[model samples]
Target: MAVLGLQVVFSLVMFTFLHKLAPYFSVGRWLLSKRLSRYLHPTNDELKQLSSGNQPGKTTGQTSKAKRRAEQRRNAASAQADKSESFTVPRNLPIQLDQALVEDIDLVPLQFYSEYTWLMDFSLCSLVIYVLTEIYFIITPHRLEFNLSILWCLLAVAFCVRVLASQAWIYLRTQEGGERILLVTFTFFFLVFAMGVLIVGDNVIEFGIEEGYKNFSTSATKFLEQQGMTSHGPVSFLTFKISLAFFGMLVGTLLTFPGLRLAKLHVDTLKYSQDRKITQLLLQINYLLPLLLILLWVKPVGRDLLCGKTFSKVKPVFYEDQFEGFRLLLVVVMCGLRILLMPKFMQAHLNLAHEKIESIKKESGRITNIELQKTIARVFFYLCVVAIQYVAPVLLILFLTFLLKTLGGLSWVSLFGETAVSFFTPTSKPGMKLPKLGGENSTLGTIMDSAAEFTSTLGDIRGIFTPVWYRGILNFFLWWVLTVWFSSTSLGVMYYSQNL
Candidate 1:
């Protein structure tokens, strides 16, 4: 508000002054040019006399004075041009370099931003696959139990993506100028989506450990006991899916490390705040924060505090409980390390932005050069707007998935209380024992047990997918509309770029 007020006041003052002087501006310019020309050059006849050496010594003096004034006028014109360009220069992408005055940009941060942005878009597309696969399981929980169903779906998605990319390329060839950026953004979006869906679905492992009471006794033991081992325990590792998912997620984290610099940069202002209201900052945070939060705190804490149930000892996502009651100590340490390096990224981004601005300023000494540089910046800015909005829907989905697991899991624990623990946690006592069921009833027991497993499996399937889609799809569409609207402005700018 304060900034807006100052701008309004400044504008009113400048316009009022300009309006009062409107009558005199042209007359003053003409008078000034005429007075300067007297010093700059004599009349044409006087120049002829000087060139013919008709006035001898007087002509030499006049000619030397004329030469000095001409040089001064040229210098003044150059300085005025510099002054005008400073105010009129466009504030967008400045990729051009001046041949005479150009310097190499050492802190090349924009390329990293480009790559990081692409990776994020790609990762969001990957998340859609996860959500879609989960949705399939929810709708037909009884069927599609076989892994091959999902595998085929992934394969189909990849093929479809390839077709779409080719079509997009053909369509892009039909367009030119800034409009092409819109096509490029969507083409790459689909391409990233395909990669996300295909890259990690091939390798899958279905692992289970059976637990039941035996010998007409209440004591529970694992059916798949370790070979020749006396001790009975639940599976000591995470589901293979979670394990591989964690790995893919970590690599994604590495890809987005550079973007976190925005968190620390411009912290004193609202420019790059950590608030949910700031959509650009939110989008960036949503891209990386959820997986990070899960990796750091949610999974580890849930495992320990949820109940006696815990994450498998093998490849535990968080550190051991040895951190003075903070099981997420290692996660905290790792995230802190990532934070520590952010200032370097911020510095790099700042250096690159400043360098681009300086390069444009240095090159903007002529009207043509000034217009050219400003046009480049304007187009670049428009393209960036398109890029930011293009990936918004996908990123929102990814963050929604993260929020579901973290919040839903916590809510389930709270709502069910101890019953939830008892239900999910396996029988506490573990030992191999004999069943005392009579032969006649043995078959009945077997059927009943099978029925129980089916019920449990169905429940697990719902648990896996429903929360992801519950509000996810609806919210995505709502935000998707807003993004399209925001990106439409870029489309207009793209159209305007040609005239620029």
Candidate 2:
């Protein structure tokens, strides 16, 4: 009961804090305004002069005076034209982040929280139903008490931290693009560390009953045995492998949405002729992809799949076949989509490139072909970096998982020797003597003892080293990233084409 109350309180705190913060973090608005001013609005000086109170016909009104004034006006106009031509326009002009745009940005976070509320409400109701069922069982003399308070606490903490960091990072990026690298770096590190702690500390077991653990462990062991594999202790490797696969699939799916959206926008931009359209598409893709990838793929995938258990001890063959099928389907669909859209994507890139080059040539007729090539190369380099930024972390996680598993056998051997030495001592004096059993008897006895000791001492270590929940985490992350990325990217493309 107390645990239930705590869950409710945590939910309230999270909702309330996010509700208050919803308006302050507005990336979309900042991007929109920046793009608008850069591609549409005239420079500050131009606007200022147009709005200025200075005029030519104030006090003088005679034929001779009028002629002198007209002559003076012609000279002034020529001078102004020269000045305009000489003025150097700023690149990547900063937009004034305002309250109205901030309010517009609030809608997204509010809608997100509103959806979250429905989920929490359903969860709370389900929990009540579960408690009532347990009570009925208890009345019939069945042991029914199950505590999930600690696990709930951990999950709440994880969720809150993830949301808070995400919002903070977004807010910081919009307010000042200067610290984006630092903020994103910090967020990534925080998520990885939190997930590591959650996994290593075994926080997930607190969520359910002891029976749950037994069922899971037994199922895992049987599955492994069926595969002609034997473990000295619990078979956590299968669980971890399944988890990672699921995470990868989920991440892939989640990423697909945004990827598709970006692909579509690139297609549209290719068909369009305006630089504004291209810029808007670029900004939208940049802002949405990072946040979506980080929130949906990075944090959730790691925590849910690596630390949480969603799959019971299932057959490796079942999981492997399912994953392979899903991967094939995903790749096929994505490839098809890419193929269909390839012409548009390429055309958009080329069109934008050509448009930019023309604009530069018009501005400076003396610009050389070599200089243009250098500029194009710089732009392409930045684009590549952006692509890498989103992909590298995911690949790194996959690599680390495999690398650790490959060294698992050596790790076990080293641990075994160290543990045996720590537990036993050699005596040279007195009547102390080691058992002198020979052949199979000695080997069998030693193997059995080693198995027992290792199982007892290294159960948690094995769990930590092997991932058993990655699939779910990865899936959750991927779903989120794809949703956000696709939506935002689409909007950006639309906004640019229409408004620009």
- Top lDDT hit: 2
- In the range 332-440, model 2's lDDT, one tens digit per residue, is 2332343333334433432344445445645632433234333433332222222222222222222222222222211212223454423332223343344644555
How does each model score on TM-score? 0.25, 0.30
So what's the TM-score on candidate 1?
0.25
Q: lDDT per residue, candidate 1, 281-317, as tens digits?
A: 5444433443443322233344443333363444533
The per-model lDDT (C-alpha) reads: 0.33, 0.36
- Clash count for each candidate, listed in order shown: 4, 17
What alpha-carbon RMSD in Å does predicted model 1 have with respect to the real structure?
22.7
Question: Which 10 consecutive positions of candidate 2 have the poorest summed lDDT?
Answer: 94-103
Error of 2 at 383 (Å): 5.5
Q: Residue 198: error of model 1 in Å?
A: 25
lDDT of 1 at 262: 31
